[model samples]
Target: MYSRIGLTGDVMLGRLVDQYHQQRPVVAVWGDLLDQLRALDGLFINLECCLSNRGEPWQRTQRAFHFRADPDWAVPALERAGVDCCALANNHILDFEEEALRDTLDHLDARNIAYAGAGRTRAEAFEPALVTVNELDVAFVSFTDNTPEYAATETSPGTAYVEIDIGDEETRAAVQETLNRAREHDPDLVIASLHWGPNMVEEPPDTFQKFGRWLIDEGVDIIHGHSAHIFQGIEVYRGRPILYDTGDFVDDYAVDERLRNDRSFLFEVVVSPTGDLSELRLQPTEIHDRSVHEADDEAAKWSRGRMRDLSTPFGTSFERDGEQLVVDFNS
Candidate 1:
């Protein structure tokens, strides 16, 4: 827990099949992100893919969404980028299968970068990762309400999910239970990261609106979500904030048609004492080199305008700072 918790969203360590790691590899691509984000206290993002060294071929389902990263480059990249914790509650965390999941856990452990939202046991999967920053204790829990045919197992690791969907009794109860546990931990702050929403849809389902408000009422300090691969609105209910979708933070690439023209971003949240959100911001990033890049002047402001417009429904405001989308919800 920091005096001001800086939260970001969705870092998918992926190597596009077409742009497969070759000369200017994926590992080289992360250098800039690492340099840019190496100083924030309590930095976090959703772990959007599995990291493995085993040379497994790409696997995909009928709908076709699978992503894996070479742990060798992935782990160090986060470390270099000053990322302290990761939310293992996204659709692709198990892309390569069970063994890959295990390897990912081991890799995370070796790096000493804490993670939550999924684990090798039911209790572990249900628990939050307690991260202490500058002596402040912060707890993080992650989940995915989307992603088909995948559920965390007592003997396996995967994203923590809402069970069925938002508003379902089982899902709300699980969320409530997790919230209760997070409260018991007495964290200075709590970050509830989620992976949800339709892939290319910009608007969140009505169920999610209710869910966000409910979580805020139940004492969640922050509610951050992704999976849409694009930016969505931000809401502030009872003074707590919810960022619905923060399009791809770092993924080598995606073939989604919408992503091509999508105006997306990465948020940096600063929550203060007394449970108030002081800073809700983002830096507009473009997909390139198997990573994200900051756009130049004109392009930067244009991108910010697009994101600002998207967040309007929820009352969150944004502006462009060079290539950064600086947001202020309380202002």
Candidate 2:
């Protein structure tokens, strides 16, 4: 048996999505991608913002941006899209502070949505969110290397974090220990969803690559990385897939033409029951009118070329299969 998993980058249902919901249901924004998403055995996305109407913004210092959504609106949107699991380990998960984070957790639980990374305590934040699909136990572990201030403490509610600075031994040890504990669950497949790296950069840093390899060495079957709003290269380390950065999946933010942050992909990974990867494909996507749609021909060509350039260095290439981009893993 094989499980087909659908993965996406930062999905912020607040702001524009909230405003758009006033006109129509949130699932309408998914456009033609909705049916494709529904066919997957599992779909995991980075919940980039809190889902609560309460809690004050962090006031110690001014933040460039903060995001939140009314649970009444956000919950239904997620349900309509058939989102099975979400990674709550990003920098913005606690934008509205502890109360909102707690509410977000409660809201997801009430809807039977599983989330990993952020929780009311340190242990909860590090624990894997497990779900059985196709009789295979799939585990998701999330962490952010971006904002330490949002990190969970022994008693506070926050996100799970791994220090980004390569030389930070203490933080590295903490991340390794968390992964080790997650491995003890012995799931059929483990996905390490890491919210790391800088935004808008095309290539990842050496430390980021090394850290991804380290996680794979520690038994993580997949490395789902985000934060760079643009897609990065894909590295298959020892047959396990490492999505260096998936780019922005759905957001209402203004796009920078130069960065091409709007260019994105819906990554699909097929894994056998024995935990071996069988196929990897990419659905070229673009953000339009606050919804996700298949990329146009011109946009598709550009995205395919960009991915080719980025993945060439790692010995990975892609072939255009109709509208989708298929990874040439056998190459």
Candidate 3:
């Protein structure tokens, strides 16, 4: 048996979606992307903003951005796209503070959508979201290396955090302990959704690469990393897939033409019932006018070439498979 899982990078629906595209239906904004996502056995994404109408912005003079989407619009849109679960461990999830984080949880709960990496207490924040597809139990655990100030505590509400300082033994031990606990659940597959790395950097840092390999050694079967606004690279360590940064799937931010931040991909991982990866494919994508569309010939070529350059160091290659790019592991 095989299970096809669709994954995407940061999805910011607050400022721009509410401002310009709120009038448009969610399906329209997602366009053909919705059909492709719905066809998968399961779909997951980083919910990069709070879904609420309450709470004030973080009281920081230097804060540059705060994002929140009206639950009325965001929830339905997510449902229409057949999103199975959302990872809430990103920086913007707490932009509206504790009240809005609670509201976001409430709305996701009311809509019957599963979410992980954020909760009212530290324990909940560390919990993993588990979903079964094709009789395979898959677990998702998320953590952010940015903004330790927004992390959850025993009595506070916030996102789960993993300290990025590789030399910090205590932080590394705590993260490993969490993964160990998740491993105790005996899931067929485990995926770590990490919100890390600097924005627009062409390559992933050495520390991140080391931490990812450590997670795989400890138990994680796949590493779904994001936070970088552009596509980074792919690494196949042992047999698991590690997506360094998937880039922005949908957003309203003005594009930086020089960085080509507009280029992105919709990653689809096909896993066998035994928990081994059978295939990995990427659907070249682009964000335009606050919506997602299939990338054109030139854009597709560029996206594929960038991924090839990044993945070559990890000994991973790509081959065109119709409209999508397939990973060539050369088994």
Candidate 4:
């Protein structure tokens, strides 16, 4: 059988969501998936929010969001469902400050749940995450555009973020850190799970695409990005599939009537022992109650049709935003 890997967009487990009257019911929805797919070997999610029951508000920002959990029911709810790996490279991971971030990491470690993205120091931040399956080693690296001053440093704790300036030498060096790890392991595959761009842009800008290609040229096997909150489109570049945004995987963002009804896809990637992504499968889905559900035949057809349009302008091709289709680049 081929290797089965599940890649989700973003997830936030915290107080604000659990208080919803139907949290338990939502848990039941995911529980079924865990039982069915646990034996598949790998499950990965972008942990969009931080979970902690500690620390003072680090920033004096008048308006901010922090995701807190009761600490008791949260991990069990997640782990019992068989989520093996988490990407902590999103903007919200540092909402609770360093202390809470540490606590969250402590809990995940105690549960034997693997995580990447933020770390106590620069070395820790850019270190590649590892998952061994069927004797193949897979490395995961995560980054974010949301962190303000909570970015990685040689001496402090924080998330790994990219910097584009020569003056910001620290952030530039962090990239080298991850690059070195990528070369050292030379695993069966390497995935850079970066949280970037605006919340609902239909596609990546020129700069984003440029960075994607740069990372690919740097020996990355897959460039998986999120933070658009909505599914944008996917592109097959140089024999590798680049998913611009996978949308929100799981959360209580269900009330957005528009997003709740968008046609989404669960990216299923099949890899060979040599780390080649030999197959790409889109598990068409529909968003309901802020969660994802497998689509019936009719919905599947509709989703496939939309995706075909979305994928058309991927390679140097882009459509201007608004009422009509205007191609700006040659495909």
Q: Which consecutive 10 residues in model 4 have the weakest lDDT in total?
A: 321-330
RMSD of each candidate relative to the true structure? 3.0, 1.5, 1.4, 5.7
For each candidate in turn, the TM-score is: 0.87, 0.96, 0.96, 0.84
Error of 2 at 253 (Å): 1.3
Q: How many backbone clashes does every candidate have? A: 2, 0, 0, 1
- In terms of lDDT, the best-performing candidate is 3
Consecutive 10-residue window with the lowest summed lDDT within model 2? 322-331
Q: List the residue pairs that clash in candidate 4.
A: 199-228
Q: Which residue pairs clash within candidate 1?
A: 1-136, 282-325
* Cα shift from native, residue 167, model 3 (Å): 3.2
Model 3 bad stretches (over 4 Å): 328-330
lDDT order of candidates, best first? 3, 2, 1, 4
Displacement of the residue 123 alpha carbon in candidate 4, Å? 2.1
Tens-place lDDT digits, model 4, residues 187-267: 887788888887767778877777777777777777778887777767777777778888775666644454432456667
lDDT for each candidate structure: 0.69, 0.85, 0.86, 0.68
Task: Report how far off residue 246 is in candidate 3 (Å).
Answer: 0.5
Q: Of the candidates numbered 1 and 4, which has the greater TM-score value?
A: 1
Ranking under TM-score, best-scoring first?
3, 2, 1, 4
lDDT tens digits by residue: candidate 2, 135-170: 778888898987888888999988888786546897
